[model samples]
Target: MPIKASTGAAYARVEGIGAAIPSRVVDNHEMTQFIETSDEWIQQRTGIVERRWAAEDETVESLSLEAARNALAHAGVEASDIDAVIVSTVSHLIQTPSLAAIVAAKLGTDGAAAFDIAAACAGFSYGLAQADSLVRSGAARRVLVIGAETLSRITDTSDRATAFLFADGAGAAVVGPSDVPSMGPVVWGSDGDQAHVINMNRTWPEAVESGLPSQLTMQGQAVFRWATGFIADAARRTLDAAGLAPEELDLFVPHQANNRITDSMLRHLKLPDTVTVGRTIRHFGNNSAASIPIALDAMIASGEAKSGDTCLIIGFGAGLVYAGQVITIP
Candidate 1:
């Protein structure tokens, strides 16, 4: 039997799911206007045909608010009922007041514990783990976890390597108490030594003096090697922590960083063909921290995965960081 909360308190389980994909769809052909890439090349390489780009009015907070509202609505919850709010992102530039504080104010969730986490693409998993701990520890009754990003704001649209990869979006989940722990503990770590594999070319202060945009830069080959080589073991470790086997998973949702990465991990795990895999990158691109939740939302929307189904999610990114967990669909 699964272990019950030692405190006799309820454990955290995902109660609601939501996502916001911008209305502006930019296809590869549209990107060809400035870059030297073609639709065929992009599709063959990233398995992405197009992606959404936020409009001028859609700030990170706005996208997060919309997604948070949707999640609360889905769970039959109200913003005022939220006991805590956590926003995960690398795009929101404010350093003083966290994005979570801003989101809570907009949602009327006054006095709620609010903060932001910077885990890059692994953010949602980290947020989930934190929410679980808070709820299980009797610190919060209900928590709103949102992963939002406006990657386009920092991306260089002309850079062929990254231009077609990153985009803007937000995804959220309402986490609450349950009799059993459906949200497993997160397995995560970071390699600060290899952080240079993917990072901004310069700091904001440096860019201000240089009069250049502080765009994202990456050593694609290095990132690919690290992801494919180490992430499979991370997924397995997460499953083991959850008392689940690869064959028991109903779905596999990794960071929509690249289709190839997902494919490689699946093969490494040797999961059965019945496991539904998330291919959200085809439409959403890589929303960084938002990727896993958005992919989870997509699976829920398409009727591919349903409540009670076990899904494995893995998130990896710029800090050369990674996090994975096994969760029951809500």
Candidate 2:
């Protein structure tokens, strides 16, 4: 007997988007109390005035559920309609029983297949790529992609370098079959040699032995150089791969890492002035994986971005990894 192949959707598109911001806000002045930095310096350096930190009542799971529910509602989809769930984050803090599984149950996903990915700041895009593939390959019909982070818990507050850069939040999107091609090819890769540029200060076992919590560490200058140079070129390649000219792009939403880096990329890409860029980092801080999707939801809500707009989104961090793609705004 001959085997049969499963058929799937010809294309996939993001049906809707949503975000969950933490309740507590941490301004630059509060950052100053923990580090030797000033308000003007923080804003001038990173374009961040303040960022949100989770309240005592908020947890990664709760944020994920909120974002997921909102996305499902926006998509006009029931929880049971989701065939799979993909969560991208480094803040789950557990080694097993993945956050995706827990979130799926909480969202009443009807036993949808669920798992998690750890690609640091590039995680959301990475998860999107997987969801697109899964839907198109018939492995799943509809996929929920969530990017959430609670970097505040792992941040070394005494370290002046990163004390103000990390925050907490969650953002999600529902991807389903599309009648037309709305998603572009994903351009992604990693450079393990530069993994040390952004990483934790210690391993779990090491932290346990030393009686200290593992905290995030970074080489800021190196990241800036790589992002502006290599990542900028990658963004250009992403736009080109999508068959879009710089002028044809309506929005540019890169990882909310640093405003200076965003400016440098703008110079490199030479995008026209009409293109709306994502500057949510000024208020949200660098929430790692959640940055891109959070920016997307905000831009759409604020009218800076609209449905059917062509947007270029890219993410890079930690693993010195990167991923970019052109997506039609949902």
Q: For residues 1-330, what per-residue lDDT tens digits would candidate 2 score against the true structure?
A: 899988789999999999999999999999988999999999999999999999999988899999899889889999999999999999999969999999999899899999999999999999999999999999999999999999999999999889989999999999999889999999999999998999998999999999999999999999999999999999999999999999999999999999999999999999999999999999999999999999999998999999999999999999989999999998
Superposed model 1: Cα runs more than 4 Å off: 1-8
Most lDDT-accurate candidate: 2
RMSD per model, one decimal: 3.5, 0.7
TM-score, every prediction: 0.96, 0.99
Candidate 1 lDDT over 1-330, as tens digits, reads: 998654524678999999888888999999898589999988888899998989988989999999999889878888988989999999997776999998999999967999999998999988998888888887888899999999999999889778989989999999999988788889999999998888988888999999997878888888888888898889888889999877889999999999988888988888999999999999888899888888888889889989899999989998988998888899
- How does each model score on lDDT? 0.89, 0.95
